[model samples]
Target: MCRQIHPNLAKDSVGLGGRSKETINRKWDELAICLNTHESGATKNGQCWRRVSLCYILLFILLSSLIDNFYNCAESYFSL
Candidate 1:
């Protein structure tokens, strides 16, 4: 006679598999974007682009502020 598995196990297994697939799919998309694949068709790609752009802009602003501060200090020291 064949024994039946618990119903809860089946449900949990299905949920686990779905989560794994979603994680793998996200990784693949990131790799594709790294390779410069077509990102226009994907909703996730739009969010990725926005996040990347925001990060770059913030970095640029940070570096510019540091440079300005350095220049101001140099000018002040030379004027003294």
Candidate 2:
């Protein structure tokens, strides 16, 4: 990721800090909470459960591809 995440994760994760990344995250969380207090559990996406899960699934696919590409490049580099 853009920032380092915990290397070892299990079924759940908890952000370890008193504050958020910045003001942007704060505002995003606020909007999400205002929109769906319990339905979406106030996720950062600010969308309903279905939409939010869709977004994350799409993101996972995209990032997985990117990581694959990075490894391919690294293999080529090492072969040189």
Candidate 3:
């Protein structure tokens, strides 16, 4: 996810080239704080949720494929 540029900082040159070092450093500090907060909340329960969801999706795919193969084999056997 991308952060929106602060209005005051947006008009300046990219990379904060035209701004004072203090202002640029302050912006970087703000960005770091935002990232830390976002990650902390996400990590609290996100890991387990992601793992469970991924496993379920993969299991569903595998089961569907197996069912399709079984149906094909049954169809051929019956047609013979």
Better of 2 and 3 by lDDT: 3
**TM-score of each candidate?**
0.47, 0.44, 0.45
Residue by residue across 1-80, what tens digits does model 2's lDDT show?
22333322212223645543443344444555555555644444533443565578889999999999999999999999
Error of 1 at 26 (Å): 18
Q: lDDT per residue, candidate 1, 12-60, as tens digits?
A: 2334565855554454445445535545554445346546656887899
lDDT score for candidate 3 against the true structure: 0.59
Q: Pick the candidate with the highest TM-score.
A: 1
Return the lDDT, model 2, position 7: 27
Per-candidate Cα lDDT values, in order, are 0.56, 0.53, 0.59
- Please give the RMSD of candidate 3 to the true structure: 12.6
Clashing pairs in 2: none
Between the candidate structures 1 and 2, which one is better when assessed by TM-score?
1
**Stretches of candidate 3 above 4 Å error?**
1-44
Give the clash count for each candidate: 0, 0, 0
Please list the residue runs of candidate 1 whose C-alpha ends up more than 4 Å from where it truly belongs after superposition.
1-35, 38-44
Predicted candidate 3 versus true structure: per-residue lDDT over 1-80, tens digit per residue: 23765555333223555566557446545644555566444432333443554578789999999999999999999999
Better of 1 and 3 by TM-score: 1
